[model samples]
Target chain A: MHRDGRAFAHKSSSQQELPMSRAYNFAAGPAALPEPVLRQVQAELLEWDGVRASVAEISHRSPEFMRVATEAEADLRRLLSIPGDYAVLFLSGGATTQQALVALNFAAPGQVADYVVSGHWGKVAIKQAKDYVRANVAASGEAGGFRDIPQAAEWKLSKDAAYVHMTANETIHGVEFRPEWGALPETGDVPLVADFSSSIASEPLDVSRYGVVYAGAQKNLGPVGVTVVIVRRDLLERAGQPRADIFNYASHANAGSMLNTPPSFNWYLAGLVFKWMLAEGGVEEFARRSAEKARLLYAAIDGSDGFYRNEVAPGVRSRMNVPFFLRDDALTAAFLAGAKDAGLLALKGHRVLGGIRASLYNAMPVDGVRALADFMQDFRKRHG
Target chain B: MHRDGRAFAHKSSSQQELPMSRAYNFAAGPAALPEPVLRQVQAELLEWDGVRASVAEISHRSPEFMRVATEAEADLRRLLSIPGDYAVLFLSGGATTQQALVALNFAAPGQVADYVVSGHWGKVAIKQAKDYVRANVAASGEAGGFRDIPQAAEWKLSKDAAYVHMTANETIHGVEFRPEWGALPETGDVPLVADFSSSIASEPLDVSRYGVVYAGAQKNLGPVGVTVVIVRRDLLERAGQPRADIFNYASHANAGSMLNTPPSFNWYLAGLVFKWMLAEGGVEEFARRSAEKARLLYAAIDGSDGFYRNEVAPGVRSRMNVPFFLRDDALTAAFLAGAKDAGLLALKGHRVLGGIRASLYNAMPVDGVRALADFMQDFRKRHG
Candidate 1:
């Protein structure tokens, strides 16, 4: 399973094989990418799919770039098995831009929208919605220290809401709501917009259930600059107005997402990532491996008892971001150093959540988690 | 000068290249990029500026990426010799987005805005403003067959006009305006906003002349997904809404253009391009080289008078996008076919304007232009 102690291309490989993980990334958001993906991208950097000039350097209007954009959307649609009615838009500005775009297109100044607040992204969505619509926090789990997503029944949804918004997975806090928690609380055919930024393609997603889904390309899909926006065609017609041209969903759809220049290179890389996902046997394959990785890391933390702890309940913990704390805060410095020396990179907690968090997205192999668990086991034994 | 006759970089090189652009790219917007810059990007695709992961793969929040972003802005400011009172923002969306943003942020409804309709981009600005403000095409060169800019003295500007909008360079029509053509009409104290999308960084610009200088990063700076906006600090305060988050110029300035994720990869690429420009002696060098290239191509057209013709009025033609016509329209196919075989890629003129257009931007070497001129001469001798 370990080829030269590196994760096989079967898992996430956002990086090329270097002697060590470049600076142990862990800076968060744009954290550690898989080494293999990095290598593949680097290998094709100049001549993508055998085209001269790094894909980034070419004209987006070129036939080659058009093909790259076309295939990337096609492959992504195939990997997710997206329905025919859904339109895919490769946009710029990240989830933050999507937050405002969604509200601007769906609800106007007096119209109401629903929000589910669980973590950083959820709060961001609420703040961003204030730009064009009346955003109501239908549910909140913050009082509980963000350890779990609120139960679907607990939401106070708006009967006249234009749409319901939620963060499927919060990167800052390792909390998640499974797909089974299907609570469509809005009345009058309100669209369901999910910010799946950090957790897309990690497991099977019911594309039919979502009215609009967007994920920035950084976390799991590919590199930065490119953002994937999947929206139902019907939603485009009723999208709100005084529609700012750049963020107008209808205008973008009508233009085939070429209202302005698309990031050609980033789009190409995302296409490769989508193809890579398909070749690795799709989402079920992604789930089986991702779960295995999560199970290993969680078991080590749960096994440590008082030595280490993860606050998120077992039922709702994210398979991607796993945040935990050591019993003694003073050992954090020594623990980080020890982990770095071992070559398992970016194993640090987020600033918002003081505990150490290891983000294991679709790319993280079982072996990486196994090593992390092994390292934790040794660290506790030496200092417990 | 020809390092390796047929092949630029080896097929067996560390990275793969895109095969689509087997010949040179001359599309107006995503036109020909410098081969050396493209090659450098390919070599560092896996690792950028010595950082782990392709520059695209690095997180925007990371210090490594931040350094690149800052440097890119610094380099741009340096290249343009921007003043200390202006703010440089790397935004998404192109000049199209800026068309609306400028009007939306700066002017109130019915506030008369003066516009100089030189070509397509100016028309777009006029269209966008019609929905929000009292937009007047104070001056237009359309009657001059869209061949050159009209003198500023002819503008019928309103005394209380909110701002005077103009396109510094029109890509589609191959026209440009010099700052020396800067006499104003009766517009009282209106800030000058210039859309320098096609001409930015190709020549030295007097930064103080315009209140807002916005250009999308695609043509002269970097890839798509990034737009560079330079606005005076004082002008930002004159906007209608400072809190209108997404497209409002004021908030973008207040937020340091990090209002969203900021198209990190594109921004980084822009920085790379900016550094390259600085290394090559900034826009002063670029302008000198551009003039030489334009001269050779125009000379061929002038020398062949009845054989080859350019519609643009001689004195005011663009030094970048050169559109011309062969006397024999029946020979269009033959001319294009021959050019393609000669390694001159994408020489076909824009769809709206039939014949040939060789967009010689900052990146196109004099040799490529010379090759084009020499081919034109030989073709004229054979057919004329």
Candidate 2:
């Protein structure tokens, strides 16, 4: 780090030559970027190939920035094997927008939207969309307190529903679907939309499984400014029929996502993360690492004699976030405080779900998991 | 200026004491930010205190980032004299959304709205709103080739209009209205709405004057991801029905702009720019510099007899952007090419408005004008 012409590095490179400065981040979204991606952004921050400005500070309408915009969408398309029938669009606002947007663009006024209330995220989605269109709980797991995914057979499919919406993984509840994509309830061609925010880029996803897919770029992907949406091309054209343009993904896609000024810096960072994901053995390696990280953390929880326990079903345990509680709830705060003193942070659970949560996203290397697991064990010993 | 333990300044900065490294940037939006603000962001890119991360890389939900969001809104309100009756919203999409959003939020289904189409920006606004509701041009300067604002006498106000909309400044067409709280256009008791994208923050306005005012944070404020909207509190709960909640000012305001993961980095950058503006003599000083810079550039054009020209009506000329043309049309490319070689970039005009444009926004120092005028004189001596 350089400040006022002074360079500072905490220490020399490791004995095995591993980079010592990488953060073992466990943030939920904009969570953790690959170490190499951050370095790439730093290198290109001041000047990009003869252009005398940072990519973030440049005009989005400029030719150079345009290259980045298109290349990012292209790379994302290649990574996800996005079908030709789909129009991949980059948007601003998080999944919260999609809750309202999916309803506005897809459903006619007063049409019911079938929502699967799996966890906290789904509840918020349904709450927001209720303002736009009628929301029907086709399925819910609140009976089980979001501890399991609703089986497809359990949903009461609506005859007049415009589409069915589900969150593939709930970061708050730490309940994930067994399959990468959620099971489609039989709805007779009623389009399905999935919020893949927490799970985006963690593994290969079948783009053909749904009519629309949207992800906020905070965890696993990149930073906090942009959202990636891949929607069927047919759905894009349908958006402008009676809907306003800005909220209509088709209008944005038609204009190359420049229907308005974009979140240029975040878009550029997302591109860097996508490039990093591509180079780091693609999603296959990410899936392997993500599963491994989840397994180690869960196994440690299960191995404990009720010192730490997670109620979410095994098949549905999230690969990105794992929420657990100490047997004696009084020890939770001390465990978190001790973990932070040992250089671990954001180990707290969701506000609605009070407990300890270690979000092990794609950026969490095996070493980070070991460190977290080590802290968990140490904290348990100190408190138990 | 240290990249790797060594001091390095771009040759442009090192070559002069003028900080010509801060050249005149005129790419419209995502255009030139204040030089000091850009330097400040670059300085803080890697670490922000004990957080050990760029503000952009932080989670939007974190307590540290929430402070950035809340304080930015507070500072903006103080700077704009925002009324207690109004809600200030920080959104992602630019002023373009406000076009449809204003209609969606204020104009209910089956109701009509009025628009004053002054130039390209207003035209874009008009076109976008027409997609959602029955919007008619209350007035227009299309006959004047969008070179001037319509006189107050010409506005044909609608008696049942939900709100009256206007672009306070036309970025491309080089026209601007004097800062008034926000004046009504012939409609009694009806609210006033203005898209002040190009001219906001240049001066203080009476907040009680308008129902809504919006500006994108590319040129005058900061980076390009977020937008600023100041709306009367009553209007938020009333008329306009939105097709999308993300672009809807009410939803964003209701959520404290944290309804979703915000563009945290851009929000932070905008806050820094606001603080910079406030520190550097507030809105009054910004106005003084803007008027001075625009005056210098216009003087050079108005002084050039048959060599150069600007066609906008003198009284309504934009202090932010000055579009001029050379008498000899063929010299345009050589002029721009020479300007860049001399460190003046993005001075090219919009393709539709051929010739040269020197957007002398708040960030542009008077020195950029002297350099450009000098370059213009040299180019004319050879080509005139």
Candidate 3:
């Protein structure tokens, strides 16, 4: 074993084929990452950019780290085609924390905030903000088992609402607002805030359509520790309710998200993911790939002739998460076990709903989906 | 080049001598780590513990990650010798967020919360909490430029204050309450809350000493993005004020810090650090090393005969951070440049104190301190 400056190069070469052990991981959120990004992270984990220290061990304000912070924001802006009138914040905590902060930062105390609840996470968004705002459920699909998004025309938004909030994708329920479902509600002046935690970067997005867009990086962005919040800069002028400076969005925007020490390592990892996404042709490429992967999996289920079923309305089905059930409940465990044995892992359904779920995020290659589709057919043939 | 499961072993052996590129880092907060920990992280970055995916790319609720979380909490409890009556939370966001939370969880709206201002961070704590509480500065060392801790006897105890808050050590101002400074004031039923961001785990701490102890993991624990909060279990019953469930400490304790998706990668890294600390003899060993390192560096400054100076009172000098100034302000930039060229990095002081600072956290070895002492003398000889 030789120890020299080319140690990373040596390690990379030696581990070139070890990825054979990697399964088709389908765990939702904190899901699969691009192989190239993970390999790059491994190579630089010890000595980053010749700085001779792990990125995690350095000061957030140092010049080396500042460049990382700046470049990440720039890349994300470019990838999403975000406008110059928006402020992007890279913050600690998850999307749930932001659920609370959104109300505190935009609404006056007890001011009405309209919510369009589509699934479990949408209900959670209300739970977090009810303390600071009069969270009004304008429309909901819960009565229909969250199988589809409620039509925007049926929403009863308040005339003086702080903002209209909705979830862009229901991760657990496998429901999404497809372009075929038609345009989102035109809120006139009240800004529309959407939780894009499970689906951001999977397709091209019109940033100007929403007043604010927030996503947890654990899904399509990168890692679990950092969250991205892009808000219209005009919202900074709002005289929001009494809150700590730490929870204030404008404070973070003004400080360039350096209001305090950020999750530097997580931010850097997310940056790597951003770079990878750009190299792979940004959201346009992922959009095409997502359609293909989702099509393959859904086709396998739809063609099973009562052997497999997906309950979500086809028009509103999530392209990211396709949750399906087997013909018999007794065979669920056996199917999951068999899938694991075949090197397709985490196919077990969430306890919230009993059925298998396959999440095809930006990182999940089309080959992985095809493998799962093949495995599903084989499992059904034996059971049939 | 081989692609076997022993890829980690191969990489470790191949990079055995790359420590030559590593400089002695002295940045406060996001600071240095034990090199062995970094190496282990690098080796396992791609595949961890026979799992086909990197730890960061797996579900936090997965059995693999749950085990990691459970073990990390157990190790932290053992390292701190925490009592059964205390609840530990591995929360996202830094200590500043906790500063805001402490008030919302423990103090009634508009209730007084006593604070002892020792340095920059102490003031920051007040700024975060003032909206939720009547933040009263009961004692302060600001009159003397934060060069000493306010004597406990002189503090004005608020009869109905929600809690008494203090910073255990001031990182930027280089002040601490040594044993010789006398015991902290008795607050009776009111719990004492502390910000131990820059000092926790440097030595053994009495878990029962205060009501709540919170520290950002970036400095002495493991990495950025996570904060550790230890609180008396009984205090969880306090109906302090209106707040979201995410900001409620009791909710976090009940859910085992899984109220929302956590910063799993950061938590895993912290667990690794906890293991390393245990293997290196825990807090007892770190305490001994901290004293020796502090003594050596302080001696170099004290012995420089006005070439370099530290103005903090001798009885209150911080063992973790030594902020010193050159006699001639014009030489400050040259001194930092020379130190960097000598492979001693990040000696430049924080903008708040602007001279030069060396942080000697638990991860800093005695040999690193000795080298800094040698460099100090060398620089003084050439410049003086």
Best by lDDT: 3
lDDT of 1 by residue, B1-384 (tens): 001122212233323432344455556766555555555555566555545445665556666677677777778889999999999988877778788788877787668898999887788888766766789888998887789778866778878888999988888788888544555444446889999888899989988878889998778775666888999888877746322466677777877787767677667667767876777778999988888988898898898867988988766788878888888899988999898767676677877788988887776777778888888888887888
> What is the per-residue lDDT of model 3 for residues B1-384, given as tens digits with 9 covering 90 to 100?
112222211123324454547788887968887777777777777777667778888989998899889988899999999999999999998999999999999999999999999999999999999999998999999999999887998998799999999999999999987897889988999999999999999999997989999999988897888999999999999998999999999999999999999999999989888988887899999999999999999999999999999999999999999999999999999999898878788899989889999999877888888988999999988989
- Residue B130's lDDT in candidate 1: 71
Worst 10 residues of 1 chain B by lDDT: B1-10
Fill in the DockQ of model 2: 0.30
Candidate 1 segments whose C-alpha is farther than 4 A from its true place: A1-27, A31-37, A47-52, A179-188, B1-23, B48-51, B179-188, B242-244
* Cα lDDT tens digits for candidate 3, A1-384: 112222211123324555547778898978887777777778767677667677888889998889889999999999999999999999988999999999999999999999999999999999999999999999999999999887888999999999999999988999998997778989999999999999999999999999999999988997889999999999988989999999999999999999999999999989988988888799999999999999999999999998999999888999999899998989999999999888888888878998899998988888899999999999999996
Candidate 2 lDDT, A224-326, residue by residue in tens: 7788888988776553236656777777888898888888888888887787777777888889988888888998899889999999987788898899999
DockQ ranking from best to worst? Answer: 3, 2, 1
lDDT of each: 0.75, 0.77, 0.89
- Winner on TM-score between 1 and 3 is 3
* Position A117, candidate 1: lDDT: 89
Provide TM-scores for the models.
Answer: 0.91, 0.91, 0.95
lDDT of 1 by residue, A165-184 (tens): 98988887888776545554
lDDT of 3 at A182: 77
Q: DockQ for each of the predicted structures, in order?
A: 0.29, 0.30, 0.42
Flag the better candidate by DockQ, 1 or 3.
Answer: 3
